[model samples]
Target chain A: MAVNESLRVLRTIHYDEHHYSLFVSAGTIGPKTKPGHFAMIQAGEGFRPYLRRAFSIADVTKVAGVPALEFVVKIVGVGTAALARFAEGTPLPVLGPLGVPFPIDDLLPSDRVALVAGGIGLAPLVLLARTLAARGIAADLFYGGRNENDVLKRADFERFLGPHRCRYATDDGSLGRRGRVTELFTNALAGGVRYRRVYACGPVAMFRALAELLAEAKLEGSFAMESEMACGFGVCLGCVVPMVDGRFATICKEGPCVSPAQIDWARL
Target chain B: MTVDLSTAFGRLRLKNPIGTASGTFGYGLEFAHYLDLAALGAISVKGLSFRPCHGNPPPRICETDAGMLNAIGLQNVGVDAFLAEKLPELARLGATVIANVWGDTEDDYVAVVERIGSDRRVAAIEVNVSCPNVVKGGMIFGNNPEALAALVKRIRAATGHPLVVKLSPNVTDIVACAHAAVDAGADALSLINTLVGLAIDLERREPKIGFTTGGLSGPAIRPVALRMVWEVRKAIPKIPIFGMGGIETVEHVVEFLIAGANAVQIGTANFRDPSLASRLVGELAAWCEDHGVARVSDLVDTLRTRPRPDHEFA
Candidate 1:
């Protein structure tokens, strides 16, 4: 079930000029939110920036013993910029706990899992990492960004996975590695660092490359796909991704998280 | 005083005048958790094709100033699957279901109407002659009065169910198309479908939507829709007009009614609030009471416009 409620903005944590994390005192949303599930966040006060933008729940934390929802917002467009400018305590009407969540139930105690993210894609993966940590299942994170400022929440990932588990790559070489994260992933795989399962969310180009790499390595993984969504529920049929079976699935409902095998990577 | 919200679109009497627009509202059941389906005037399911469609590729939708654009090429589970799966559930819900039918050809349209028209669960068949997304038969028929008339006439002969011809706003004179539909034996008329629009992704240096152009819908298109509805109502006073385009609030609903729409459909607003139509039913009743109106139908074609003085103008 989804609820449209006026969630109060608790605070905004600015990671950099263009990136920030919004924490809201949403008691109703926190319990229902799961990793890979997203909220349709109303950008501003009225219908000017008309549609509610979809944002992955970056993290769910408790403040003053009350559960709160956090979203990592990047100012890429007018909607995000509007949301970024909102003052604390502003009433934000959110509709969510929507879309299919990442399946983590089948993970074994000893199985190794890899969590990969690109830029703002880290929003959903961070929550997944937190859940995995709580389950005593440690997953290494391979994070990439445009530059040093773009690669967000390094210490948070390290704190959750311990030192050396959180790796990074920046396109401009302003971060740890001087190449794409896919290169790092390739090297890791070549060096025989085997992961039982892999989870990724990123740019379409990056996902395409990863899909190929996963196929070549004969590895099992799921990808959290993003599309322009009108309704974050199944109704709209606006946010669709072509599946391998030639049927278009609504990413907002059927996914945000989908198996790589289910997607027609070549067509994408 | 009890405010009667019940309304009629041709022979079909709805419990209220509020319904969800086709393509915006999925096959009724998707919103079951958020709303009481039985409360809606009707549930106009997503546009259906003769066969299941894969629709367009990624980035099928993009937000505009007060609206959004979509090129979801009428993706559906085909007529057979809808009958096998969706209709049974809709029947159980005891909700009035309006199947919005579309096709690639005239035969395709007739086949779809024939398949669902006999089902008692489906209260009416809304022929989609105005979808701007599809390549053939959609807006092509909608743009031409002769084509629209001929298509409606054929479908009218095929289905015994009340036929609501959905018109495209992209035409030069929507009244002509409205008259064409009425003359061809349409039970009612629904307008306007989304206006053709395009949005560019500057960074990618390409269209934001997978299809270069898509149909624009929302609050942005409301004024245009109201004008069209008013014009069509004036041209064909007796026919029922199901007006819809960017209706978000009860005020908009009243505005559409005053502009001569017997019934109004909520489209994009459903994305923001799934239970909006259900809420609007009570709001409309409250509005009728506040305005000293006994029946909601009394508000239809109530727009009071100043008459032009004959001596000055001529």
Candidate 2:
């Protein structure tokens, strides 16, 4: 079930010039918020910009004794730009605890999982990482970005999962391994690294490549897909993704997190 | 003074004058978790056809200035699924259900309406002749007076349910289309469906929407929608009108009524706030009471203007 709340911004943590996180009072929806669940956050007042922006729940924690929902956002368009400019205490209307989350229940303490995040894709993965830590599972965080500047929340992951368990790959070789993050993933798989399951959140191209890699590697994986939507719930049907069965799955309803087998990468 | 918010479109009566627009309200079940389903005046469920529609490809919607463009292609569960799966729950919820029916042909439209005949649950049949996103049967039937008349007549013959023909704003002459539906037995009319518009991505040199062109809706089109509702109302004063287009507030609802709508539907704004239509029902009542307007119906066609200049409307 989803609840609509007018959560005021408690603090805005800037990861960089473009990347930031808004920790807002989560009302009743925070306590139940899961890893891959997302919310439609309204950044503007009245009719300006007209639609709420959908963001993944990075983490649900407390700030100064108030329960809060953390949203990691990158300035991409108008809605995000407005969110970037929002002052502290500015009330942001949010609707969520929506969408299917990454299935962490299937993994045991002995099962090692790989968490891959690209750019602001780290938003959902952070909560997932924290949950994995709590469960005593050994998970590796494959954080990738265009450069060191684009990489976000590295210290947060390092503090929980340890620096040795975290891997970094940058497109420009500014941080760690050079070339695309998918390339690093491909190299890792080729080098005979094994995992119980892989969870990923990134651009569509990354998922398309990962789907093929996972298919070839015969591994189970979940990809958190993002789409442009009006309503974060199932009604709008605006954020539908083509499935292998020739039917479209509403991302807002069926998943923001989906099994690699469920998507039609060719169509996407 | 108590404010009377109840309104009617001939045989069809709504507890209030604020209903959810077709395509925006999906079977009235989606928003059940967000708000009480029965709280709205009516739920005009997504446009249904003889068969389930897949709609357009991804990237079907794009945000614009105070509005958005969508080419959803009217993705729906078909009429049988709605009747079997969706409608019963809506009826059970005590919400007024107006079936918004569309098809690829005139026969397709008749099949859906006839299947829904006197369900006892459905309050009215809103014929979606104005969906600009579809290639056939939608605006094709709405753009021409004779075609719309013929289609409405066929629909009229098929079912005893009150017919509300949703008109397209893309037409050259809306009054002719309004008259065609009314003369051919349409009980009421839903004015100003989304206007067809295109948005381009300069980087890709391609259209922002997957279908090249999509219907534009939201506050940006309110002025155009208001003008159309007023024009149709002035031309066809006697027929009932369910006006809609970019309506998000009580003030906009009042504007529609004064411009001659018996009721108003909240469209794209429902995407922004799923509970909006239900909220507007209460807000409208409070607004009416505060303004000393006892009856919501009293606001209909109440616009007063100085004598029109000879060339103004022409």
Residue-by-residue lDDT tens digits, candidate 1, A1-268: 7787889888888988899999888758788888888999887667778888899988898656767898998898888888887787898989888888998888887888999889888989888888888888869889999999988988889988876888899999999899999998988899898898889989998899998899999999888888877779888888888889988888888898999989987777
Measured against the native two-chain assembly using Cα atoms, what DockQ does each of the candidate structures obtain, in the order listed?
A: 0.80, 0.84
Per-candidate TM-score, chain A: 0.97, 0.97
Q: Give the docking tier of candidate 1.
A: high
Question: DockQ of candidate 2?
Answer: 0.84
What are the runs in model 2 whose C-alpha is more than 4 Å off? B310-314
Clash count (model 2, backbone only) = 0
The global Cα lDDT (0 to 1) of model 1 is 0.89
Local accuracy of candidate 2 as per-residue lDDT tens digits, A1-268: 8898888999998877788889999898898788899999988697666899899999988889888899999998888878988888998889988999898988889998898888888889999998999889998888888999888888889876879988889999999898788887888788888989999999887788888989999999988889998998888899999999988989988999999898888898
Here the TM-score of candidate 1's chain B is: 0.97
Which portions of model 1 miss their true places by more than 4 Å? B309-314
Clashing pairs in 2: none
lDDT tens string, model 2, B163-205?
Answer: 8999999988899999999999999999889999999999999
Number of clashes recorded per candidate: 0, 0
Q: Each model: TM-score of chain B?
A: 0.97, 0.97
